[model samples]
Target chain A: MPKVTRYDAPRVIDSGSIWILVAAPTIWAVHFLLSYWVAAVYCAKSGSGWLGGLTDPRWIIVGLGGLSIAAIVWLGMIAVRRYGGVFVVLEEITDSSEQGRERFIGHVALLLCALSAVAIVFTVIPGLVFDRC
Target chain B: MRRGTSILFGVLFLTALGGCDGRHNWMAGAGEEAAAIGDLFLILMVGAAVIWSLVVGAAVYAHRRRAHPGLEREARLFVIWGGVVFPVLLIGALLVWGLFLLKGITADEGDLTVRVDGERWWWRVTYETPTGDVVTANEIRLPQGRTALFRLTADDVIHAFWVPALGGKMDMVPGRETTLALTPKKLGNWGGLCAEFCGGAHALMRFDAVVMAPDAFETWLAREAETAQVAADDPGFQVFLDEGCGACHTIRGTQAAGPVGPDLTHLAGREKLGAGLYEMTPEHMARWITDTHAMKPDIDMPPYPHLSGPRLDTLVDFLMRLE
Candidate 1:
């Protein structure tokens, strides 16, 4: 029999970790929309009203945001309808076998570490290269 | 309740941090306000990032050490907090910031004016000088300390006007007019290129934006506006007019009324010839007159294959002396 960590709402909610992935698409969408608005203003001001024909970034943001939210919501709905069994099976298997849990945690940690490294490069490298110019 | 709210707030804060660009300088010129607006939106993104990191950090902490039975109940609260409250707040703030930026950019009363037209593979820059003279050329020049208003349009396909140091890009679409504004504060030449891929030689369609002091620009304007006067009896000068070379080019004075190509009224005074391919030297002028296609391949200007030997030398001499 698989072990269940009770049906405590607080424990389940506090233990769930989806914010990082969620934030990626959300932040990018906002950035895209903002860029679109900025570029649109320039185009409109350019006195060449024909720029209105090009595809604006706002539409992309909306489409991406809608898709991401829908996917997350759908996943959450499936997880709930399956009565915690959706993740319980995977977690129980990993927890019972130390090597399995280590492997899973190690994979996630490595991915996060790589992402953090990339973010730092993107954030800091431009300043170093363009500061004098 | 507290943990749930903290997670939501954490996520927003993380977003705000991620969107920051440390190299952002102050918005200085005409189209600079748009950058300022972009900065505000970035602030919102940073806020979101901060919130995300904090929320995820707390969640991980809770997962590792909090073995309490009520965790699932807490998860419901956290979800509601993030899924509903956080998005509502985040989007509301974004909307407000976006509106503010939009207003700043759209405020009327531009200080300068310009007209940019994109052809098949080149840019046509027209500056309407204060003295009622409209100077048209491939390169863009601006007098420092003055706002340059740009009216962008395309003669063929779409092309984007971009000068990274000055401002963001605006597209030039066919059959329509788009307006952009820029005020080049510094006194130096800037590189400008077409951001859109138009056709063959698109990469070669480059232009230099010469930003000069106000006095220097005025002096240049005075010289540019002067009539090109050839001494009445110069044989080589007559050859220039008679060879039909004047038919496709313009000289401020004399009978060269052609507007099919670049204005050569003050071509001798420009820093480069053949659309920035060669230097402004007498030898380069002769070579260009002898074989323009060899220097700038695919140029619209036809090569003077017939003007060779003495004819080429005399024509180069006459053109070089036009200044």
Candidate 2:
């Protein structure tokens, strides 16, 4: 949004849809479901945990959590660069331009990434908490 | 305080203390695991109290302060420290402690092994000895100070075997076997129960966990191993055999060898009948024979209404002599 003094000024901007808002939490939601479901189904099939050298649900959940956190971090970097994702201060953008809207979206997405990362950690904690199902 | 009021207070205090002796009291600390669990519960309670006090104190201190601009940074630090860092550290520590506790309690080895199979409304118990498996029912008698490992499973449905005073509960899955270890420190009868609701008689399904002296337990096990001594010409034994009771019940050392129900070889020896629902006595036995559902609703055993008067008495006498 630099000063356009001439009529023939060139500009390029992101034309992505609003789906970016849900992308971060979607990872968290999928992780949450898969974590509990995997644990439950495995425990049901194998009975009590601590099976001798078998598939451990704890490590599986940990790996899933690590992947989720990594994905959130990548999204977070994008959000911070575009929207100034300081996280502590949330100032409203009143500009109705496309850039302003994109910035707002990016800011919201950044906050969501943080929230989702925290939520994913919470989900992973239960995986560590239980010794057996 | 007035004398009457003091007396009332004393009575209430004594009554509260009396609640500690109940068979299913997890706080009784009768077993090694229960004692450990009790200690964990105490630690958790104390930790929670301490955390609550600290948080409240912080909140009060913050509330009483003046609203200066300089206080904003301090307030943010307070929120982050008290709200975020403190809880994460405390809960993480507790979780680690609990995981270790769980590891310590869930043992893989024991001095003796007892296999318990959960039936619809009863328990079929078998003690694994070097000679062979000594089958029994309803009542589980373990030697005090020795760890008794229980291999538990269910016949048709899922049931949770919980002797609260002894240790943590484990589920009895139909196709899968779960193991639990109980090392009773005290010689007493701790109540065991079916914590999971399986069917109509789920509430009635229970067992007597009797922890005895080591020598006494050995003697009891020896006596229990022997088959019931059934005389050839006993009229009561004749009534038991004639009434088809042998089809569903087993009296070892005799022709009545049925594996469908609880073993009745030492039925009278058990303190409780109908799976710990009633006292093991002649009156209860007679009633149980005539109307099985009256003692425990929705049991698999059918009532014998026609076999009344002398016939029922003879059968009851034969069963009572099983001790």
Candidate 3:
């Protein structure tokens, strides 16, 4: 019988863990579409009112955006702790080693997290400025 | 080859310059909102031009110059500073500024409300006053320096209401009402049209946005509210009824209570007829009645080809007298 190895390439990096790389951008896209649709529907149904009034649609958008940012931050933490992602420096992981591929994914995920956070902030701007429809 | 290219560019530039004389020019800055937007556009255009020149210049310099292996850190720094940092800062600033301008232009309410219903190829305008609603068609008159809130809605299909000299376009969707506010600062007949293509004769769908003094506007609105004063047994009135013109047109204080077409109570008082397609003249009116398709193809109004000679003349005379 052959002896079992201590590391077996981490089971091809697991399909489920790949989602961590794209979680931030996916959350951003969802938040953007949801915010726009909600505002349009609400404006069409009910006319313009005072800011922070009863019929204001900004509250829902802000709430969802906050929750999405929190989730992305959690994913970023996982990437840093387990996948060896560095915040300041981008790692060159072009080698064929399994550890290199994992670190590459983590680095890309970290960058995407920052980009998605910026996009989420941008998405919330229209609500902050426009008090009415 | 370079000389030929230069000549071609010159011709193109001249053509573009000539095209600026169009009646629907938004850069005229005839209204407060339009002027605000125009100023913002000019600033953005200058900024964009500067940025584009810098980027292209840098690209050309990089491509032509000899590369050194020792300058890797310099190149990376340049990419970070020029490509990433500059673009982020510029775009972020622009976004905030644009949002601020948008907030400034948009108003919750105005001094007066004018409900404009977008039809397939025409506008059904109604002025809501403290007394009552004054119904009109194809023309909008406002007082200079006073804001007018336009409550826009479409009956059949989607259309966009645009008075370029006045302000930006607003979509008129069916089953929903969209509002836009305009404060005209100039006294002129600015062209208004349906920006969104609906169906046939969409291009012919136009209106005259006339800005006047406050007193003049008040007088005109009051006069427009009054009913037409015509003899009951007039030959022209008989011809109008016989030709079924009353079925689709309304003449105030008369039995002609049709809701399909425009109200003809103040037809002669209008600056243009056929929805701003022609100057309001008796000759054009006669041609419009007989050769409706020739004037505006695929219009809802049928041509009165059979009614010629005295009958056509009488009908035209009656419509002309509807001031």
Candidate 4:
């Protein structure tokens, strides 16, 4: 009998949950597009930079980014529960069982979440910096 | 092998240093904004060099050392500090600095304003005076120590205004007006150009940003605003009219008032001819009229290959005297 730690202690593993791999990046992409759209529309509409230079649109982008990051964090939590720990110590995820596949998906998804979070942060920077079009 | 590598790097460094000189050097520090930009570039270069050295040095050190048991804690600390935090901080600081620099250089207002319209292969320059607008062509003269806001536009396709020694490039889009400000610190003919490729003669389109003393600039402007002193019975003036040159060219205070080409009321007074292509001499001026395509290909100016001998010589002579 295995002395199971909570890392591997899962009740019912979803057999094919590969959508988690793309979830974080998808959120990042959506946030990036929306951020750009908001800024472009704002600048184009008001040439003089009136109404305080993308202030309203910038806050909207911040809210969207916050929501996206939160969603990614939630996805990351799900990945962590199955894969174990923040650090991916696993060299390779070649496990073939239902649990093995779930672990493999979790491993890649966690990395994607970290990358997406970093990308989202970078996207928010230009909005904060530039005061005008 | 190490000696050879060092020699190779030395040669590369020297070669890179060679680009620091000449007229088109953006790091010339001829203007206040240009100097600020030059400082930013220097900082960026230094930071990059430092970062590269650290990364390579770490790799070399790790390579030379024997991997024994574990320095896991130290390694983790190194990764977090060197890999994550350092890059984040460096990029964040640089981004902020760059944004501020951009904001500073892109100031809309200035001590004075000059509007320049970019044509197919030339610049139509207009200086605002207290009396009225003083229009000129090709050459852009700026007063030293005074910030000149440039309102730029294009007649046909897209073009770009750039005085490399003074400041950055700004686009001149058709039907749109973009503004750039340049304050000259040095009194010299720092070369100006049309940066964006427009057509066949795009590369040939050039000008001189002549920084003059404020008083001299005022006197020059006053002179430029006045019309040319064309003699009523000048033979060259008669030839210019007979040849139908007035249909495309304008010589103010004369009957040859064609608002199509450059305002040649004081063409010879300018430093260069053929849109800053040749020296403003009789020889270049004569060639420009007869063999226009030879000097600058694909130009709108029709070549006067038929007109030659004394007629062409007289016309060139008359143009040179307008100064």
Pairs that collide, model 3: none
In candidate 1, which residue ranges exceed 4 Å CA deviation? Answer: A1-133, B1-69, B87-108, B129-131, B232-236, B320-323
Rank ordering of all candidates by DockQ, starting from the highest: 3, 4, 2, 1
Error of 1 at B246 (Å): 2.3
What tens-digit string does per-residue lDDT give for candidate 2 at A34-53?
99887777777664545523
Retained true contacts (fraction), each candidate: 0.00, 0.07, 0.43, 0.14
- For candidate 4, write residues B193-241 as lDDT tens digits: 9999999999999998899999998888888888999899998988889
Residue B99 local lDDT, model 2? 69
What are the chain A TM-scores of the candidates, in order? Answer: 0.29, 0.76, 0.76, 0.73
Displacement of the residue B315 alpha carbon in candidate 3, Å? 1.1
Compared with the true structure, what per-residue lDDT tens digits does model 1 show for residues A1-133?
6566657334322223334334433443554455456455645654554544454434433454455445444434433332231322112334545445444433343333333333332333222222111
TM-score of 4: 0.84
For residues B279-317, could you state the per-residue lDDT of candidate 3 as single tens digits?
999999999999999998887899989989999999999
Candidate 2: misplaced stretches above 4 Å? Answer: A1-21, A40-59, A87-133, B1-20, B56-66
- Cα error, candidate 4, residue B76 (Å): 2.5
Instruction: Order the candidates by TM-score, highest first.
Output: 3, 4, 2, 1
Clashing pairs in 4: none
- Report the C-alpha displacement of residue A57, candidate 1, in angstroms: 22
Candidate 4 Cα errors over 4 Å, as ranges: A1-16, A47-67, A70-111, B1-19
For model 3, the docking class works out as acceptable
| Comparison by TM-score, 1 against 4, better one | 4
